[model samples]
Target chain A: MEEEAKAKPRNPSGPRLCCVCNTRRAALKRPKTLDQICRECFYEVFEEEIHQVIVENQLFSPGERIAIGASGGKGEHGLLSINLYFCSVEDSTVLAYVLSTLNRRHHYGLDLFLLSVDEGITGYRDDSLETVKRNEIQYGLPLKVVSYKDLYGWTMDEIVKMIGLKNNCTFCGVFRRQALDRGAAMLKVDKVATGHNADDIAETVLLNILRGDIARLGRCTAITTGEDGPIPRCKPFKHLFSKCISRFCSGVHQGFGKNKVVSSLTIRNCGLQKPRAILDIIKSGEDFRISTSTKMPEQGTCERCGYISSQAIDRATKVIIPGWKWCKACVLLEGLNKGLPKMGIGRSRGLNNDRKDAKGNDNAAKSIESKQCGTLDF
Target chain B: MQLTLEFGGGLELLCDSVKIHKVSVEPQNGAEMLTMKDLLTWVRTNLIKERPEMFMKGDTVRPGVLVLVNDCDWELSGQLNTTLEDKDVVVFISTLHGG
Candidate 1:
């Protein structure tokens, strides 16, 4: 296949040899002036229908900092990386890719990587830090290595083992999520992008739906820009399938990050076989589209985490709902309101009158209607 | 056979007791008559504003509330729709998110 690619005069437009299975042919190609990756690799990326993803949600605008969680895994093939850089070449230059990795002891990969043109960390996080250094020279962009232990209180190995896989998924996810944002804050980057491949997105959607996680299931779109939260994160690969992404990634040979054929996940080593891992039970909805399976629920914040999670404030805000029993944002918010009136006005707006209006009514319908500060129909 | 039902948010809004099943006492008394779905429906229709979208879809649902179907998180059984037999202990407890 290598000889074939070299032997034949590259038709500025023909499919090239695959990046992973060099035995097969790629399905796509890059333009002569754009990047140096093959077409097949292009499809394997969330880059396939990028315009649709962006336009549907109106993601990009002037002065937007697109922060990317560069896992450097099977998710971020060379084609997707370079293409993403090229797409944002002009107006959007502050591309801070958050390298969310685990304890090197866990042996996930990318040790002491140069995050920038030549920037590498001295001790812990040296490998991934070094990769970011190399990325700077390779793409001539800003790179930041985000560490998880500093912010989340545990490394992947420590967390997975202690919490025991099933529940550890949430721990790993929450830590890495916050870790990226904290890193982005350090770098002073605004928006963020992540290489969450199709498989990852689909699995999450399925899991959310299975658990009746109304909030997560609905908002897991290809491009979810966060509002009422810090640093909006957008995903361009939310809709494509894994096979296409794999097909597209296979043709990527040079220039950008590697790790194309590794497993379609970063949680491979956590040895997940637990009851809550979702991967075990949430089967892929073959021939299913995001529109068909999801019913985007209303948007609200977790009174604990303050992150853009399910926007359900009613049940979650109940007295019996427990304070620590909310989203990370909700929990934080609840804590902040501790020792003070839970609801009423607080220099911003007053709801004491509202609470009084429904007091003693206990009628679900009337209370709901009055709670809204609007007219009641039913 | 008096059972206590400690709901999440709305429990405070209701009286100390309500006649759920033939048992004219607390929710715990009619543990067999009540369910996660039933409790949710009551909350949706009488207490809260919206609805609990995915309450029971076989094994797909995670038990959000700490339902002691005999003093154990329903995660012990397939959550959400776990059925209750005779003398089954159904106690609605609290939930825990993160730190």
Candidate 2:
């Protein structure tokens, strides 16, 4: 093993030099630029790019309390949170390590906390949460875990049992969004940062366009979303690529810094979508402009939960349930509790007609259309 | 040549949940040195027990999967053409899991 470690430069004839520094041997080929750079130069450029994005977009303000939405599952491709703390150490490791170092190097006086949502998936989330716990200790950041069972009285395992594999992701997705917001609220943070890279945003853009969601398509590309909501959300990695994030996470896992065990998984096959298509979708989303004359849903607070929404009730059903206007989340919970899984689902009018006997409102109901499973609703 | 292969980022799930494997790989009949392409083919045939599609696409690994040879990103080397020596450590990590 020692010999293998020392024998990294197999070709001794002419060593490949870092394109940027042009002195040290190249460590990795950058995916974005395909440039072969030494580790030091890569560290400089990578951090510099992220710093530029944060500064240009004004992602954060000094002294703001930020909650990092750390899922602790897939480190890079999955929702991983980047927290800024002050540590005066000069480390060349990736984001997490660099951010910790920057805490001291740059004195970014930000109170960062890790807020994780436990979806209560037995084998999957259970295993990943252990990694999140390790990270909590490793980074010396306090962690708050909000479970689906605790928040919604249903775990993903239970939801899957009731709804089967077909639309279980819908429940999980909607619940997760609310859970993250609630978790952030519990943390009392000013802003929430999620580890959503450029690819995820591009994918959201494509899905929105495909679904004809002009409102979401217009706002999906924004670095920070839901600013008007209870807790504002930001994506520091919005301009960053998934490949770069994965490389950085993998580097940290491979013992690049003070982290001991490989507590995070960095590799993820984010579907079969080509990189070119992802970039194009993001570009198209940026260029898209919704005309003012077009009819768009007006934003309003849900009567039941007081959450911000473009629609008064669940977006799927136009019929206002006699007394209360519940948000999509409350409506989904009502369906789950009332043993009517079809409520607030596809073609809400048909389902509403069947349930009219319960409420006795015979008004014409329009189908509000439901989003597909595994797609971002925002 | 003998090599130590480490699978991570849920890649072990495809290979009976085994993280590490020490195996011997021989170059093709006329070839003198073993390149990553040969090792990848050998791994696909010998190591990956299921979901070979998740690990390999076309000739190389799926776009999201990362390969490191001797603790260095394979891209620094010639990727598929990266030559391997005796007792080298190659890591395959799939970044395709839930976040």
True contacts kept of each: 0.00, 0.29
lDDT of 1 by residue, A1-378 (tens): 344333332223543455545644432322111223333345333242554565566655544544555542111111111111111111111122212111122232322222111111123234334444655665445566555445443455554344342332333333344455556566665556554444355445554443333444445533554654566666554443322333232222111222101111222111122322333322333323455454443445554455553323433344546553344323322333353212211111112123454334324322332222111111
TM-score per prediction, in order, is 0.40, 0.82
Q: C-alpha displacement of A39 in model 2, angstroms?
A: 2.3
What share of the reference contacts is kept in model 1? 0.00
Among incorrect, acceptable, medium and high, the docking class of model 2 is acceptable
Assess the local accuracy of residue A189 in candidate 2 as a C-alpha lDDT between 0 and 100. 98
DockQ of structure 1: 0.01
DockQ of 2: 0.41
Give me the overall lDDT of model 1.
0.35
The per-model DockQ list reads 0.01, 0.41
Writing each residue's lDDT as its tens digit, candidate 2 over B3-42 gives 9998876778778888889999999878999999999999
**Candidate 1 segments whose C-alpha is farther than 4 A from its true place:** A5-57, A71-133, A160-166, A247-250, A254-378, B1-99
